[model samples]
Target: MLLSKASLEAACGRKTIRAAVPSLVSPFQLTVRSLPKQQTERRLVPMRRSKAVSVQNNFSILALDDDPIMISTLQAYFQRSGYHVDIENDPYRAIERIRKTHYDILLLDFLMTPICGDQVVEEIRKFNKELFIILLTGHKSMAPPIRTIRELDIQGYYEKSDRFDQLELLVESCAKSIRQMRTIHSYQNGLSAIVDALPAVYQLQSLEQLGGTLLETAAGLLHASSGYLFLKQSDETPAMHPQKDPELFCTFECTITKEQARAQYTATVFPDQKTIVQQNKMSAPLFDTRHSMIGMLHLVLPHAPQYEQVQLLDIFSRQAVVAVHNIQLHGLVRSKNNELTQVLGKLRDSYVDIVSVVRLMVDARDIYTRGHSDRVSKFSRRIAETMKLDRETCERVSLGGLFHDIGKIGVPDYILLKPDKLTFEEYNVIKRHPDEGADILAATSFFRDIVEIVRQHHERVDGKGYPRGLTGDKIFVEAKIITVADCFDAMVSDRQYRKGLGVSAAVHQLQQGRGTQFMPEAVDAFLSLLDKEHGKEVLSLYDTLPSTI
Candidate 1:
């Protein structure tokens, strides 16, 4: 259904109706200036004369209807109110335009040829859910059911009248809503970009990679056409020079040379602590962990950015500071690591000889305990290997096992070598060896990583055994492995006070102690090892060792 002739006459005076363009003329060809002087006089009325709609320059509208006059009136009124407006008489053409172009609000007529407004809305809802739509009907009764409107997400509906006061109010409400939605959408996108860019930034190992990643992420977030990143050369040196000039490290579609960026950094960005925006360009200072200026970032955006974009850029700049500082710290760590590696190489032989002498001294003091540390170290390493632990962990566990009983050196000879069963006081004295061993190893940086294992090797899974009553996962896995190996060897190896529990008895003890005194996984791995052919050989080797005092 098209606009009635009487309604058209009422909208524009009769003389203006006679001047209307031919229906065959395309709607796109019509403009406000082409309308008759009297037709243009019929302007849309505002809901409140003093409080008119405030439209943004980019806020736009698409008016779709079968009647040319109705489309013309809407276009003229919206354009006059400072909005960008387009009109389409064919629903198919309107739908195609909506698909290709972004319009903030759509003004749709309820009646049209071939298909109605509801059908057109259904087709559009298939692809675009964000477009704000308003249905215009000749009468309230002609409007689609409320259910259809809700399912299609139609934002508003209005009865067509001689004056467009109600329609104007609805458009104002939609414009405000669109502004908020766009702001939220932009914020979400900016946060997601920051999240995605940080992993790439931190993964970079070199200063060059760091600079490029920081520049790319900042530029992409700001939608800048080009940018330059300048970082301090002194960050690579052992001692930093705060006043030194920064070198340009990266450029993205940038025409400026290094000298130009350096000049801008010194003249424009260095003195100002706040971000500076001039027309289409922005300059933000890069800071270190101490909040000292370490560099500058310059970007050429497509237009002067909004307050929200500036805020997001500020956030990105703070994270970039962390990235830059991490890169500097990494460089220092790499240099120090090289020096330490060389020093450790020189001390390697001497360090081994000293540990060997200590082991011999501990064994020489007790005939029954001879070869005990070596056996424990080998057994612990085998358990670690059976558990598929890393090479470094296996090595650490072996070292830990070797030194696990070093604390017993501090015990009195009468107590350590006593052939009689230990009273409660002597047993209490025995419990202190783990702590003493941890202290001895902690004195050397070489044994730093294994100190916890040495300290907790006697700890029980049920929190019953120990220098410290650590339970379950609180015990280091390396410590747990050593605990299982140490307990097994102590149970099966001879001591002066009693006959050694034979291999079968020791296995029974281990099975009884599972979960109550030992980590279940460690026990399982060690038990699996004992079942192997090599494990039988290890047991035989233990049997061949001297058992006499």
Candidate 2:
């Protein structure tokens, strides 16, 4: 049904209106000189105002109406209401405004010139996809047809019968909307600033420097009194041996200890700023590079009242952990590159360099057993010396122990440290150690003897062992000697799961397993050597282990 002018005005009640720009434009200043009133003087008069207002820099409202009085009234209303409202008596000018500057809200005259309000609305939409438009007309019939509003996503339609009252409310309502939008914008800006400043400070290399960054930036953003960052390093020196570095920390906990953190660092690293002012949870924020689980960061207030916001502190703590992890990954790449570069350099050395390099690797694997391969090699030489083996044979025996379990490099840390029983699959994996050891030895020159020893280390007297199990004399004497030493070490050294038996108990177990698990002669020789040197005195040699460690 066709609608009349009064019907449209009747439908236009007092509903709220608001202005929101999808994008904001920054404003620049233009100082203009005032021009003189008389042409005779041709003097300049001070320009009182520019086309746009300072506060309205980010927003612009375009108003179009054919009636000069009505258009002038609406313009005056918006200008006083803090809007940079552009006026267009010609509906075509409204179309031009959209093409030129960005406008947030469009106020169009339903009774405008050359183009009617409805036609103007349609054209404005084509060029200004985001401009929100409202229709204004004195004749209620001039208001948009219901079909247009429902389909066009238009803001609203206003009737002009009560021009002064309706236009004032329309202008004020859009202003309130702009104010609320500004509120949300300010909040978003603050949030972005805080997050952006974080990575800048967290990248500090030294703990003290990182701590300072955490404290300063955190206090500035979170309104924290002070805070600290904590971090930890993961040890990767093979699973048979475990090592840990002192955890790094960034905290505000006035008094905190490593023992205390070890007990409770997993819980809330960010204490509620609300509760922090109320009680201490003994927790702190933790983070590090390498993408590793760095320790926590703690934000502390000397007095709880000193901090009004701890939630921000918590957010920072969580972000720091994520940052630390990335740093650790970067460090790992660098370390691996260095290791590969070193390996490439070593590739140029001689055949004897292979044996020298293997000895160096064993010594370098862990501080606790830095000289272990060397010591075991010496022992193998003495035993061979006693047997009056050939010079080359004796040398092979000594070097064999040096590379005996070198295949261990293939074992993953978790599996190597398995503290409990293994499935058949896991045991099968463990069985590959001998072959792996052999492969490592065979990779370089002058290692054929050592390779043979590694490959045959698990082969037994009864032909029940792996990788071509050889019975009796089929296994090399040197290989048999390594089997004895390997078993002795396994039996006497503590593992991830179990404590080793003392030397005497281990010797007894060997005696029992002889001919079944070991050769009887090797067992006899092992026991005779321990009998000469007190087993108790050998255990005492490790007393130099760091007393404070």
Candidate 3:
């Protein structure tokens, strides 16, 4: 189980691990620990102790700085790595401490009080000759720190103004130096994690968490105070996140961020003590599919130095390239996945709509014809199988049967759902369904093939049919198949106001009209299959059959 900050702090008897730490390592350094079972007061009051926390450990650090925020940030970053962090805020106090105590690492702030920064470092080396001294400066000045390094044997130095990503690298480098471990690229894993969680567009809370998580992990490797991430929008609005703006989706919530801490960093911003804080846009990205190097991540330092440029930002730039590639890949996958999901949903809806509309039309007719299209569609598909039509063709034929009477949408309602037969006017109106359906369908682009089947279902094999008296050879083969199935189902169905025509009579009617109404070849094919086991199975599926009586 992970310990809460309150519990850990209470157990340690300190507000933070740094102040509680002692210079020398021992169990006596346990300023606080497993608490009393029951205290007179649950709240532990803060105490100023003479001893340091984690002094019994192998390493000791003397972090010297005037800015408490900067000291706190570094202390916390190192504390998580299981190292002792001791702060020396006053420059006078820092030099005195270095003279008296034994320290493994010396962290000195470049800008401080009471004495000059370089003077403190010079004095510290005077007493503790072998300390692994590191200058934690708050500026981008090369001359002061570099001159010292060139002159003396300074173990390591970190720029406070470096992006947290850089700080993390420095920390890792320092840790690895002391521990004698190999250095690894901090970016490979960060880029991979971000890539895995992509398409860049995520829910607000999730995105914020991702930002912090990636930066923190990256910082752990870079040894920086924090990291920052920003994306450029395709378009911009002046009043950003104006009113509950969804555009302000990305955020900064990490304790480790590019927020201004009280640390004096050696920034390469200005020659004097003046700090420059320019907010540059992360737009016009250089990232793309084949090669990705996006907009710059300005590693803004509080003060300017003569020798800071592309080399200083190189590590971040390389990592940024990976981030761009992973993010773009995520975007592509998400877009395609969303598109496919939508398409599949539409196809499903079309299937439902087709079945419903056809059923509605059939219901508009008599009860006996209620399941006509449904059953015939099923049987026509089975017939298509024996005809050896490909699966796609078979499926289309089945769908066409369901919509064969779509032209009936144009048929007068009185004549369509009517229980009685047609008068002269009703017959003419009924005959118009094929043309009406064809016209209705011609308006849409994709349904032209379906429209052909609808237009010809009424046309008979003989020259006596209504719509286009186009006899045998004039009809399409698939339409000829539907015409046969249409007659088979219609004859077998009992009219609303008539006794049902038994299955035998229905089949006998078709056999008699073999060459007259249906294509003889089509009728022969359907009957041959109907005489077999599967045909009987198809017939048995319905309560009544169109038997050739």
TM-score each candidate.
0.54, 0.38, 0.38
Q: State the lDDT of candidate 1 residue by residue for 240-327, as single tens digits.
A: 2234434536899978888887777777744446677889888888877556677888889999988778778878888887887777
Which is the better candidate, 2 or 3, if ranked by lDDT? 2
Listed per model in order, the count of residue pairs whose N, CA or C atoms clash below 3 Å is 0, 33, 43
Q: What is candidate 2's lDDT per residue for 1-549, written digit by digit as tens?
A: 113433443454432322221122211222222221122122211111222333544567887766555566567656755678778788776688788888778887665446677787777777666566767655433446667764665666664442234444554555556656665665565467567886685573643455456656665664445555555554421211123344655456346666665555555433332123335322344433333344654555444532324444556666655555545555566667878877865773564576567557644554434555555565566556656678988888888877776665666655665778877888888789889878766766557657878788878788998878788888898887767776766666555466667667887888888887787776676566665474444455335433321
Model 3 poorest ten-residue lDDT run = 15-24
TM-score of 1: 0.54
Worst 10 residues of 2 by lDDT: 39-48
The global C-alpha lDDT for each of the candidates, from Candidate 1 onward, is 0.77, 0.59, 0.54
Model 1 regions lying over 4 Å from their true place: 2-56, 80-84, 96-102, 140-148, 233-248, 255-263, 267-274, 352-549
